[model samples]
Target: MSKTTITANGQTKNLSLEPRRLLADVLREDFRLSGVHIGCAHGACGACTVHVDGVPRLSCLTFAVQCDGAEINTVESLGGDDAHHLLQRAFREEHGLQCGYCTPGFLMTMAPYVEEMAAQDRMPEDAEIRHAMSGNICRCTGYQSIVAAVRLAITQRRNGESTQ
Candidate 1:
């Protein structure tokens, strides 16, 4: 067993795990982050996306040993203990999720994009949103609602409004 240290969602833990274990397994099974869904398990589905060192990456494709000292942010870090984040609220308002299997990936992948746009106070076109979200595949509905959610979140953030 390899002794690895991973800081997840603001909590740091030292673990002794197999060298070949996937980061998704460590996050879900060890960290108890159930939101890290395993869809496709080949990194194509994007259902296991999470932020490692402030960048979105496919957890399923990453080995836990590779992230020995990395800071990982899962979906749990988005909202407060009792409140939803702006993107999450926008998603719910716009009905961006149906089956919800792919929501976590989409959230992790798009959070930075939306935050960047909001920081610039820029409204993104659907094409730009589509381009940013191209890496994530949502098999449930068309991309319209997801795009709408991104737009809504951008707007809400730019205006400094909280959905709570």
Candidate 2:
């Protein structure tokens, strides 16, 4: 077993886990962060996407030990039940999700892109949005709603609305 410290969803956690354990397993099984889903287990599907040190990464392809001292952000960090983040609200307003199995990963993957665009005070074009989100595979919603949701969030952000 290896001892590691990870800042997850704004909470610092000390963990003792097997070195070979997948980060997805550690997040879900050990920490009970069920939002990190394991799909394909191979990193091809971005269902297990999470932010490691503010960059999106496939948890399935990463080991628990590899994330030691990393700041991890899962879907849980996005918001809470009382108030949803702008991206989450946009997703719902735009019907960006269907079965919802892929929503968490999509949200994790899109958060940075949206934030970057917001920081630049610009909304991404449809093609740019598609390119940025190409890594994540969502069988449901056909990605149209997802793209629209992102666009909406960007618009909201530029209109002086708080996204966080």
Candidate 3:
């Protein structure tokens, strides 16, 4: 077992983990953060995406030991002040999620995208938005609502408004 430290959702823990243990397992089993879903176990499905050191990464494809002293953020960290994040509210209003299995991954993946675009004060074309989300696959929604949700968040942020 390799000694590893993972800071998840602002809580830091030191753990003894096997070299082969997937990060997804560590987050779910050790941290008890159920937001990281293991859909494909392969990297094809973005269901296990998490923010690793402030960047989106596939937790399922990563090793716990590899993350040694990395800071991680799961979907649980998405909100602050006891309210859903902008993207989350938009998703609910736009019906971006149905079964809710893939919602966490989508939120994790798009949070940066939406904020970056909003900060730039640039409105991405629908195709650009679709390309950014192409890494994730959701069998429930046809993606129209998903696209709409992202657009909504972008609009809200650009307008200096919160989805609250």
Best by TM-score: 3
Query: Per-residue alpha-carbon lDDT of model 3 for 45-155, expressed as tens digits?
Result: 799999999999999999999998899999989875343888999998999999989888998999999989989999999999999999899999999999999999999
Candidate 1's C-alpha runs over 4 A off are 80-83, 162-164
After the best TM-score superposition of candidate 2, give how far the Cα of residue 150 lies from its true spot, in angstroms. Answer: 0.5
Separate clash counts for every candidate: 0, 0, 0
Task: Write down the RMSD of candidate 1 (Cα, Å).
Answer: 1.5
Off by over 4 Å in 2: none
Q: Alpha-carbon error at 59 in model 2, in Å?
A: 0.7
Write down the TM-score for model 3: 0.96
Residue by residue across 1-164, what tens digits does model 2's lDDT show? 89999878878889998898999998897778898988799978799999999999999999989988999888988876533989999999999999888888999999889889989998778999999989888898999999999999989988889877
In model 2, where is the ten-residue run with the lowest total lDDT?
A: 74-83
Best by lDDT: 3
TM-score of each: 0.94, 0.95, 0.96
C-alpha lDDT of all candidate models, in order: 0.91, 0.89, 0.92
lDDT per residue (tens digit) for residues 1-164 in model 1: 99999999988999999999999999999999988989998868889999999999999999998999999999888985542988998888899999999999999999999889988999988999999988788987698999999999999888998644
Q: TM-score-based ranking, best first? A: 3, 2, 1
